[model samples]
Target chain A: MEIADDSKNSKRVVFVTVGTTLFDALVRAVDTQEVRQELYAKGYTHLLIQIGRGSYIPARSTSDNGSVAVEYFTFSSSIAESLRSASLVISHAGSGSIFETLRLRKPLIVVVNEDLMDNHQEELAEELAERKHLFCAHPRTLHQTIASMNLDSLLPYPAGDAKPVSKLINKFLGFPED
Target chain B: MMRENQWLTSMAESNGIAVIVVTVLTLILVRLLYVLNRCGKSLRPTTVKPLSTLIVLGSGGHTAEMINLLLELQKDRFMPRYYVAAATDNMSLQKARTFESSSSSEKGTPAQYMQIYRSREVGQSYLTSVGTTLIAIAHALWLMIKIRPEVILCNGPGTCIPLCAIAFMFKVLGIRWSSIFYVESIARVKRLSLSGLLLYKLGIADQLYVQWPQLQRKYPRSIYVGCLM
Candidate 1:
C-alpha cells in the first residue's frame, strides 16, 4: 500500500510475464498469500507481474509492503528492460517469452497454460525441462515449484548463430563464401 | 437425326477441351519437376555480388524468432535486405526496422520494409477471405518481382506461403532463381505449421529447416537445425 523509495532498487526482483496474451490463472496463483510468502522466504524482495491483457488484476499486498512488494501492469512497450533487471522470471509458456528469458540466461520457470487445447507449449516445456534449460510447472503447482525451486540448476541456453543457417543459404544459392 | 448430330458435336468439343487442358497441365508439371531438380543441384547463380535478401516476418512470435535467428547473419553478405510482413501485423515491421537501425554502424546495406495484405484475417468470413487471398497472392507476386531478392528467408508465417510460392514460380519461369529458405517455428515440436507443410510438401522451399529433432524425424525431408532461437 505504501511505497519505500529508498528500498525500491535494492529489492531482489522476480518478474512474471504473460506475454501478449491473457492468463489470469497464472496471475491468481501468483497473487496468493502462499506464493508471495514462499518467494519472500526465498529472499525475493519484489514480485513484478506483467499481466498483459488479463482481466484479473493482482491485488497489491498491503500487509507485506516491507517484506515482498507486489506490482502489476497490463503492458509495456518493451519487455526487455523489465527482463534485464529481473533476478528470476516466471513466464507463461509462449515461445517468445520463453526464448527471451532463456537468451538472457536467467533462472526461469515456465508455467504451461493447460486451458489452450492441443498446445505445443507442453512439448516445448517438456523438452526444455529435460534439458535443464528452465523449470516447468502448471498454475496449480506453481507455489510448490517456487517453494522448492533451485536457481542453480538451470543451464544457460546457448546463444544461437545465424551464420550456419546463412551459410546453408549461400551454399544453396551457389554463392562463394565471403 | 439433327438432334443426334448436335449432341455428338457438343461431346466432341468437350473432349477437345479436355485434351488441351491435360496437355497444358502435363507441360507445367514437367517444367516444375525440371526446375525442382535443377535447384537441388544448387546451381551457381548468375550474380556474384552480395545477395539481395528477402526476409518475411510474421505476427508476434514468428517475428521474435526471426529477429533472433537473423542476429548473427553475415549482414554484409545478405546486403540490401527487404523485409515483408502482413499489413495487419503492426509490430513486426517495426521490430525489423529497429533491428536494422541498431546494427547500422557496420557495412549494413539499405533495409526496405514492405507490408502486404494478410491472406485472411482472424475471424474473417471464409467467403470473403477468397477475395482477400487472391489480393494477397497478387501482392506477394508483385513484391517478389519488385525485390527480386536472390534469397528468401521466412520462419513460420502465413504470409510466407504466397511469397515462397511465387518465388518458386520465378524458378519455374527461368526468371531469377530466389533460393527459398524456410525455418519452422521452434514452437512446432510435434507437427509442422501449415506454411511449413506446404513449403515442404510442394517442394517450394529449397531448404526447409525444423528446430526440433522430433519434427525432423517426422518430416524426413526437413533438415534439422537445432534451436535457431
Candidate 2:
C-alpha cells in the first residue's frame, strides 16, 4: 500500500486506487502533480494518487518536474477501505470499484479506461454523467473538470436509499410484500 | 309547416353520416382485434414444471444486478436457490459475497452461492469455448434432475445458450418447461446483437420482461415492466 504524504495533512483529500496491470497509459494520463500543487496553492489541499491493482511507477516523478504530492500503490484490502472512507474518490470506471463507491454514497470522479478493446466503461461513464451523480473526466478535459469540481455541491444518494435497486429486483422476481 | 319540413331533412342527413362513420370505425376495430387474437393464439403458453431451483447465468455488472435481485427475492415466500455460471472471474462474485454476508448479518439465512464448472482456464483458447459450454450443459442437467426448476429466468447472452439447450432437452424428455428473459433497459434505437439473435433461436422463452414501452415490437410475448433496475 502506497500512502501520500499530503493525505496526512490535507483537509479535503482526493483518494484514487488504480490496480496494477502493467498498463501505464491510464496512470500517465492523469498523474499530474502540477495540478495538485496548483489546487493546494489555491487553499485546496488536493492529494491525487494511484493506489491498488494495475498501478505502475514511471521512471521520473511528476513532483520532481515541479508537480505536487501525487502517490501510487498496489492492491491492499486495508487501503481500499481507506479509499472508501475518503471524502471524495477518483478512480477508473471499473464496475466493482464504482459500485462500491456508489454503495457508500461517496462523491466520485470516474476516468474511463479508453485503451480497452470494448468502450463499455466509456458507455457506463456517459450514463452516470447523465444522472449527475458522478463527475466524468477524459484526458482532454481532466484539467477543466478538476477545476470545476465543487465538493460542497455534491449530492450522493441518501444513506438508506442505496437499496432501491435491490428492492426493484425483488419486485421483478415476484417476491410478495412483507 | 315548411320550416318543420326543412328541420327534418337536415336531421336525416346528419344521421346518415353518423351511421356511415360508425360502420367504418367498427370495421377497423374488428380487423385490429382479429390480428391481436391471432398473435395471442400463436404465443400459447407451454406447460412448465414449477421451478424449485433457478440458475442465473451472466458475468460482470449485469450479473451483479441479477444476483442482487435474486438475493432480495430469497427473503420472501419465493426462495429459489440459485447457481451462477459466470463467463469470467468478474467482480460480480465478490460483490455477491459482500451482499450475502451483509444480508446474513441482518437476518440469519446464509445466501447460497455455487460456481458452475467451466471447461478451461480463463482466456485459454477458442476451442475451450465449446468445451466450457458443454460442461455448462452437463452441470445444468445434473442440477435440473437434482432440484428440478420449472422456469429459468435468463438475464442475457452467454449462460442462456446452455441453459436453454438443456431446458429444450428436458422438454423432449417429457418435462414441462418455460423461460423468462428480463431486459433491463431499452435503447432509444433498437440494435440487434449476436446474443439477441441467440435469444430468438432458443425459442423456449414464454415471457419477455421489457423495461421500455417502445421495445414491445421486438419480442412476441413481451410484458412491459418499466425499468427492471
Candidate 3:
C-alpha cells in the first residue's frame, strides 16, 4: 500500500472551510505545522483555508520542498466554485457546507464545533460518517482523522431528489397525471 | 295593529336568520369531517385545474433547503407560486425572485413574493412577540384570502406557522381546502423542529415528511421519504 506518494499528483488542493460563523478551533487545528506537513506528505500541494469570522489568522507559508503552499481568506460570495476545484475538503459541519461538498462528490471531512449552539451539527456529521459518506471529527480528533483518512472508502452521497416528494404532493393534491 | 304586525315579522326574520346560521354551521362541520377524513385515510385523487401553490421560505438554511426542494417540483403542476417570507428577511425574497426569474423563462406560472411580519426575532422578548405574532397572523390571513392557494409546501420555518394555521382555518370554515405539506429539515435528527412539531401535534399538515428514519420512528405520523434535498 504505497499510496502515500504517487507521481504526477501535483497541484492537489486541500480546502479547509469554516463556513460563515467563527470556527477558530477548526481554523487553528488545520493551520498547524503538523497538519500541513501531513497534508503535504499525502501529496496535497496547497492548503487553502476560509477562516470565516475567526480571529486566528494563519500566516502564508511554504515548506522547504516548496509544496503545501498555505493561504487563508475571510469569505467568498459563493464557495461552490472553490469547492468544485478542491481535491479534498475539510469543512465545518454546517448543513450548507456539508451538502455542497457532498454534492460535488469530493472527499470530505466534517469537523464539528462543540461550542456552537448544541450537538445538531454533531448529529448530522456523525450520522453521515456512519453511513460512510464522509469523515466526522471533533476539533481535538482532527489531526488523527486527517492522518488515517481513506478517501476511496467514502461513498458518493446520492444526489437528493425532490421529484418524488413533488410527485407525492401532486398525487396528494389529487392531480391526475397528464 | 301595524306595530304588532311589524314585531311579528321582525321575530320571524330573526328566527329565519338563526335557522340559516345553524344549518350553515352544521353543513360546514360535516364538510370539515369529510375533507379531513379523506385526508387522514389516503390521497383522494380528484381533479383541480392548475393547483395554486404557496411556498413559505425561511431565513438561511431553511430557505436554501426549500429552494432545493422547489427546483425538482413539477413547474406546470404548481402554478402561480406565491412565496412568503418574513418581513425582515430581504435576502430570502431576493433569492426567491432570482429563482422565479430563472424558472419563469421556462413554461411555468409567474412567482409572486410577499412578506409577513416576522412574528418573533431570534432574541426578541416573548411579550413583544405576541403583538407581532398577531400582526403576522393577520397578514397571513389577508394573504391566504387573497391568494387562496390550493397547496402549501413549507419546511422548518417560523413564518410558515401563521400561514399554515390560516390555511387550516380555511379548511375548517369550508371556505377553501388547501393541503398543507410540512417537510422537517434534514438538520433535525432525533426530534422535530418547533414548526414541524406544531404542524404534527395539531394535525394541521396534511402530510409531514421527515428525512431521517429515526424521526419517522419517533413520530409515527410522519412519512419517511429519505433525504429530500
Best by TM-score: 1
| Model 1 regions more than 4 Å off | A1-10, A63-67, B1-19, B45-47, B75-79, B105-108, B120-135, B174-176
Per-model TM-score on C-alpha atoms: 0.85, 0.63, 0.82
Model 1 Cα lDDT, one tens digit per residue, A1-178: 0112233456688899988879999999999888888888877888899998999998775336546888889999879989888887999988888988887777889999988744767788878888888899999899899999776677778866656676676677666767
lDDT of 2 at B22: 97
RMSD (CA, angstroms), candidate 2: 15.6
Query: Per-residue alpha-carbon lDDT of model 2 for B1-229, expressed as tens digits?
Result: 8999899998999999999999988876675454333321222233222234464645545565566455545443333445556646555556666666666544644345555655444235656677777877788677566655544655654555566566655554446433344444222113233344455544444344454455556755555554333
Query: What's the interface RMS deviation of candidate 3?
Result: 2.2
lDDT of 2 at B191: 28
User: Cα deviation in Å at residue A150, candidate 3?
Assistant: 1.9
Per-residue accuracy of model 1 over B1-229 as CA lDDT, tens digit each: 9999999999999999999999999988998889888654575654467788999999877898788778867677787999999998889999998999887786536899999989876446668878898999998988888988888899987788888888888888778787788989888888998788988888888888888888999999888887777
> What's the CA RMSD for each of the models?
4.8, 15.6, 5.1
Lowest summed-lDDT stretch of 10 residues in model 2 chain B?
Answer: B40-49
Per DockQ, what order, best first? Answer: 1, 3, 2
Give the better candidate number (2 or 3) by lDDT.
3
Off by over 4 Å in 3: A1-7, A62-67, B1-44, B105-108, B120-135
Q: Write the per-residue lDDT of candidate 3 for residues B92-130, one digit (tens) a residue.
A: 989988887886666546778898887877557768889
